[model samples]
Target chain A: MSHPEQAPEGRRRPASPTRALAEPPTTRTPETTRWRICREVIIHRIDDEAVAYDPGAHEVLYLDADAFEVFKQVDGTRDDAAIFLELAQQHGETTDEVASRFAPVLAAMRRHGWIGRTHGADEVS
Target chain B: MSTASTIGGRDVGPALDGYNPARRASCPAAPGPESPTYYRIGAVTVCLHSADARFREPFHHLYQRHYIGGPTLSAVHIRVDRVIRARPLGRGFRICVDGEERFLLRKPQAVLPHVEWAINAAVAATLPRYHQLHAGVVARDGFALVLPAQPQCGKSTLTARLISRGWSYLSDEFALIDPDTLRLDPYPKALCIKEGSFEIVDAFCPTAGALPSYEKSWKGRVRLIDPQALRPHRTPWGVPVGMIAFPRYVARPAPALHPLSRARALFQLLDVCFTFGRYRAATLDVLGGVVERAACFQLESGEIDATCDVLEAAWRAHVPASGRPDPADLTRPEEPVRPGVEAA
Candidate 1:
């Protein structure tokens, strides 16, 4: 079947905390997973809608849907491969193409704290 | 840098005109035969004038180029330059509609596609002092449907469908909220139709105009259509927003309406707002008050009939079946965020 491919690194099923410890400490800090909008500010979590809170101005920025999804998949547990697979599945695209097309965007998102990944569950083994 | 006035307890300022030569050419401040375009959402008077008639072809088309879409209206106001078009009214703003009174904002030049952005940003810029929301408002049977979506989530598609089903198109891009009464100010302009969905709309309602495609967009080519000719009716001013629904155009077997949690609802409302940061405290307070009162839900559907039925039912159940809300206090929540990313 020509289904969307999983992120090249492979998909990690949601595992228990025990599996998390065996992996190397994840470097996916907040900064590594912020959603960038208009190439200006970085936002976190956008599963629903997104509002940006500016500390200096004591104000909030509203993000449209496109920016919302791009920011929602930044959890450290999900690798680039997983993110690509998920987006592909949602929009109907092949994973290989998505990965090739999304690498730079994901990297840019990482620099802004929009996505992150940790050592595999079997890294210690 | 003139003194300030008050409207519904909010301070006011003088009308500021743009300096761009192109803009000046389109909208000269010199008194012309054309009357000033003023919109009264409660008490706030948004006075806009443009020398160019091309910008006025379709009321909402201007919004397509700027923001997403929302509730909007086009009307004429007759007034002497001394009072209606005068400098800041020292303290009291003229009351043209209902109990609400708002300060005046006048822009002499026509700013295409960017008009909605300027209007919404201006309203949001005064946050904490006033409330503003980034949402689309459509109405049927005196009640309005508020659709707040992240980009490319078929917001414009659903809006176009609602118009076909006889709902008055309030605004397709964004809805501006008044801080005092928690009412929605009309930012009605154009509808932004993205690719993939563009074909869907063309099939659903071929009569709606789809401008030539725009290329290289992440969502593919988008067309801005003037729903005025296609719309069934004019959305009444101050149509009480009865239902707040999030539309997801998934090709599923059936359309379902899922209830949303207040926290999640609040989170989403924040996400869909136009300029939460710009409005600050007022935006938060108004939005919070609205979310507290309105019913929030997620709509999953591939079929328009199912979606419409579910939406209509939700509206009748929550809102009074007799008529819509007072025109000034139509409150809307934020659209759903994708995931992990909270709603604006």
Candidate 2:
């Protein structure tokens, strides 16, 4: 269990362009995580343009856009604390709040066999 | 009974989903006589709960909730337990049957045609490495034939005819391939015996089994000929694809076989595909692998007997003539998957 540095800008919320143009966020209820058989391996859009894959055991697990963004923030070069602060600044959320949200998403992804846990220099650094 | 439910973020009741008021002005529940019994396919699986029936032949009713009347002969009901948006074309419709998401479709509406298509799509999409073909696959004595034909080209009729003559019907519409082993996965189901072909079937097998024909489709009338009626001899797990035949039924007294270049056959198969543009890269990769290994032939048959003869001869030429060899002997290793390749 580790903590990230506080954002220098303190806890300013990010202004999401998606939030302004979109409908108000429905209650962010937790979706029951399920492993849908990968029909097509799409690393793209959420709509019909998504790709399908028939998963083999050797397949790399993938994340949806929301999940992948959380994953992209993880760099082996940075410690959890540094990574948290950078992502919080990028998304304009408090470091603590961003880490709290990131934890559950990572847990969900790991549970679904998307990504395996890795210990690297970035986390130690 | 278009019960209310939510689909694609819209409060789509049965009526809205079926009639699509924008697509059709009048919303008629279109009452038709219900069949006395509902036939269940796929060997009775747990997904029965999600199955929706579509009348394909001898009946006009598809399902109680979803009904689109076209001249149909056989009906298939599929309960789609999961509709995930996974394909690049946005049509990754998978149905849970046989304990696997065996079917995959690129256009959502394509699965709506018949339950068999939905199930077939799921099976085809999930197979390892090999191309999922847009053709009917039938086999006999461990030898399999992939028939890729354009609509009105008598592919189904040929399938029914061959199945009647001891060929095991893999599927009347789809052919699934597994790249890992180069085996043709069996998706045995009903054959879409066209109206004109019905007479040919009657003449050939005289005792041929067929469902009733619906007189409402653009193709005059169509019916389904059950594969089981032919008493298929083998339930072989999978077969190596041996030949690719593009067949057309023209009302000529004579039949002709045309040797098509692999390129020509590939384009022809792609052209007849319902969702090639949607599946794009995956579909291209799959088909490309298949065409490379199998010999391609075009059959112009004016008569049923002549068509069968041409097929038999072609089979003799491409398939091992010694008979009943292990499927593993004929298969070739699959080509490596290229990176970031989007099929045009």
Q: Please name the candidate that would achieve the greatest DockQ relative to the true structure.
A: 1
True contacts kept of each: 0.06, 0.00
DockQ score for candidate 2: 0.01
Give the Å shift of residue B244 in candidate 2: 0.7
Q: Interface RMSD values for the candidates, listed in order? A: 14.1, 17.4
True contacts kept of 2: 0.00
lDDT of 2 at B218: 47
TM-score of 1: 0.48
Off by over 4 Å in 2: A1-125, B1-130, B209-211, B273-279, B282-285, B321-344
How high is the CA lDDT of each candidate model?
0.49, 0.49
lDDT of 2 by residue, B81-132 (tens): 3355644646344554445454554433334333454455554444333455
Residue B189 displacement in candidate 1 (angstroms): 0.8
DockQ of each: 0.04, 0.01
lDDT of 1 by residue, B1-344 (tens): 22233334543343222212232344323333254454443223344444333333222133222221222453222121213543463322231212232323233221233343344444444423334455667876665677877666677777887777778876776665656666565545556676667666777667533343433224444555666645545545655556677776677857888766444555566666656545544555566666555667777866766777887777766676575433234333444332222211
Q: Give the chain B TM-score for each candidate.
A: 0.59, 0.59
Worst 10 residues of 1 chain B by lDDT: B91-100
